[model samples]
Target: MTATTTPLLGQMMDVPLLVSSLIAHAARHHGNAQIVSRRIEGDVHRYTYRECEVRSKQLAQALIALGVEPGERIGTLAWNGYRHLEAYFGVTGFGAVCHTINPRLFPEQIAWIVNHADDRYILFDITFAALVDALAPQCPQVRGWIALCDESHRPAMRTPVLCYETLLAAQNGEFDWPLLDERSASNLCYTSGTTGNPKGALYTHRSAVLHAYGASLPDAMGLSARDAMLPVVPMFHVNAWGLPHAGPLNGTKLVLPGKDLDGKSLYELMEAEGVTCSAGVPTVWLGLLAYMREAGVKFSTLKRTVIGGSACPPAMLRTYEDDYGVQVIHAWGMTEMSPLGTLAKLNWEQAQRPPEAQRALLEKQGRVIFGVDMKIVGDDGRELPWDGVAFGDLYVRGPWIIDRYFRQESGTPLVDGWFPTGDVATIDPDGFLHITDRSKDVIKSGGEWISSIELENIAVAHPAIAEAACIACAHPRWTERPLIVAVKKPGAQVTREELLAFFEGKVVKWWLPDDAVFVDELPHTATGKLQKLKLREQFRHHVLPSALEVGDKCPLEPLDSDKGAASGATANTKSAATRG
Candidate 1:
């Protein structure tokens, strides 16, 4: 007798999880909720979900009239405002792929990405009219240029442009959104292309829906109808970390700041909108903290924030948690995993621990979420133990993880079914992950690898230090040593000896940088990580002090510091993991 298969007793409905459904749910169930945007025209734009639904239909009709077909890529070169949000729903709902181009990229990169995507219609804000004109010749595949403005603000450009309002006005009142398969691609976002040519991360409707659902859970971002959300992260960068979709799914009010992500602008918008939660990188928060300190203001409404894109300094974390009574969740992800692999929200048991212990736990990248799984592997492809001491290359597998780059560029970026995240990290027994350094950025000094990230994090905790980065520089004996590039707070100064003294006990003597050099400002990637490759090149032939050799007295006498006393705790404390 053959083995029999079992089936469910009740028949279940199989409605596809399309991007259109998110907006539809908002329009029908939470029709009156507000989606506010600070427009580029120096005015706040407000619209209800019901209004957004109707206008999105009109824009879809416009796309159809312009001969856009399902699966074709549509480009958006605009800021984080109402128009961009409309473009998102319009392009994706009409069955076309929405490709959001980062305007902050170099012209060469911008042109290359738009051309590579083979975008049919490039919808751009008025601010980018000049850029579009410059890029029009290179991107000949763009059939039409739709300026995201009215007839009054229309720009004269080399390519014939259509006014956004006029195009929408000409379209009929409504459009019938097709029932696309859940697996169809809905959004396309390319990486910053720091090392090589940028690769696109094509997200499907199914993956995006699941990502939003996972992000909205109580343990993840905890988005709900009662919270007002401000996503300072750009819409072009990883789809603003998926907040746009998550907001609608949970009926959360959204406040989108256009091109004005500066300190004053963000603070005003957050205060006026009563924003309860926000997400951005640490650098952005640094500016906000400075502005708040000078202006003598506090975040009256913001209760929590999520910091990602790079490691968050412990001092910055402390300011929000200690001074303002706001919770900080350290998130770690890349563009590959729908940008949310792990979020460092405290568990109940961990929450019961002391503040110092909690800070130590929060320093590491948080535990993995439900949809994602991770593992550490050594050179021999053997799985490493999660004893928190043995650091290895991090690999991740998940429903939303990319199996291959778009257009098969650098085809199949997976190793035995897992994507290799280039960062070196350790997994604690309790499942927390501490990212030590990027494989490229790790410094090898006298046969020992020093984590540049860990050093930089410790350096920035000093009261006078504003920003810091560690780069590997040439040395006579060691071959490579950690070199520090630090920026001081305005009107503040500190000696190199004083700064290095704080790191004496942080790690072994060799781990500290040989010298500290102050700079006005450090370079940053488009997505806000420090541009270390350029720094490495600048100091490649740097000469070290004559006296310092492979083995010498610790740079400076040990001084008291929180990170110094608790240094190497993550690596030294080894315990067994409860999970396999």
Candidate 2:
């Protein structure tokens, strides 16, 4: 029974083949399990596993008839809905790559990604009609466009277009999904490119299947059929953390919050569908928490949630667990690594601790799952220890992880056999991973490093702050200094002096933000991480001199000098000393 004695390289399974097998299993054993979709037309659509399989087969056949080649890129600019789910399987199930375009990205960025990926067909939701119409003329390689909406919602277009439902209706459900090489490319995702132009990460069938398997394990996400799953995370980002596949594989009921992702709408859907589990970013949860607090709405059926795409603040995690009786699992990943690298669920021993202690442990990214090997290396290319005190750059290697960049083998950032994560973190004795900073985001001032993420986290913990970002700006004395930019909560008034005082007891006095700038809102990347580079550029010229520098530069003046008397400081004392 050993794999060494087995034949045919473990059956040469591909992602499409695995998906087809899972669909058949669901149809046979879980045929009545539900897939619910909230439509933009103010209607609710529902389907079962049996119906989904039949329609998915029809979609696959339709793609084949429309001249979709095995490796051609087919893009989708849709939301989380059943029709979008159909494209998820149909495109890749036919051995073509599904390129998910983020609708939130700038139009120019969208056009760049589409043209760079050479996407030949695009299936979009009707909500993006204006965006698609504007970009369609520039996408030369795209040959066909399909709207995921039905006849009633489908908008008229001048370009060559087809209706998604019409195409599915025209095709027969008798076609067989072709056998494909397991290593063949199956999906393409571009990085958010906050610092530079986005690069495509083409995932192979082998990588996707393995990643789906890893995501379903107990130590990883522990998803099961008993859990009613709702993926509020958009389909355009990292395959909604790969739950679209893991859910069906586990026979879980799926609730798709289509165009209406507002707090009231999501809470209502979860209650109606009896949803037990959901996944989204911290921003979405913040809105939901505010809505619930304001309306006194409750989710009796919701049991757990997974927060990702950015760090989950300890306050947000505590609110969900303590107030709503829900467990918030924090996860971290990028567009690469099939977008699932780390999760914040406690192990058995940690779960046995007190609630407050458990929350502290869960704040850090959890241990790496099986099939993933991780290490932190210093600037000297030396591997750091797992003591949790010493921070270094993180690196990972696994069966499902990417080994090279698509179409640019020489430009990839693979180190030895591992992929450089571009993140700075420390691993604790308990094997938990904590991200202190991104490699580029860490600030080196006076030869000491400062974690902007840590600063931003502390700043946002203030009650009056809605969001905060920290960046390094050029300083004449320290070489670089930390600048804090913050957005205030609605109807909250927090002056710079008061806000700076809030950080007094929490962090080192020197670590406090040199100067605080208030804005209505902070700019966020397409993937939800705060855009610090923009903040740095906006405040590069502002700087505060240190006490030593001020003392050295200014000599004592006469006590009777009018300049010192008017400035609120005695003539004998400099401004730096008085402020300190």
* Best lDDT among the predictions, by candidate number: 1
User: How much does candidate 1 score in TM-score?
Assistant: 0.93
Query: Which is the leading candidate under TM-score?
Result: 1
lDDT of 2 by residue, 274-335 (tens): 99999999888988998999999888899989898888887778878889999888888877
TM-score of each candidate structure, all chains considered together: 0.93, 0.90
Residue pairs clashing in model 2 are none
State candidate 2's TM-score: 0.90
lDDT by residue for model 1 (1-580), tens: 7676985577789899988889889989999999999987889999988788788889999888888999999999888887888887889997999999988888899999989999999999898988988899988899999998899888878779989999988877577678999999999999988886899999999999999998997878999999999998889899899998998899999999999888899999999999999999898999888898889889899999999999999889988889887898899999988889888878899999998998898888889989999999987989999999998899999988889889996569799999999989999988999999988788878777899989998899988889999987666567677877788899887887888887889888879788777777888988898998666544443445532554543332211221243244332101211000
How many clashes in each candidate?
Answer: 0, 0
Candidate 1's C-alpha runs over 4 A off are 4-10, 546-580
State the local distance difference test value for candidate 2.
Answer: 0.80
lDDT of 1 at 70: 95
Measured over all alpha carbons after superposition, the RMSD of each candidate to the real structure, in angstroms, is 8.2, 7.4
Off by over 4 Å in 2: 1-17, 545-580
Lowest summed lDDT across 10 adjacent residues in model 1 is found at 571-580
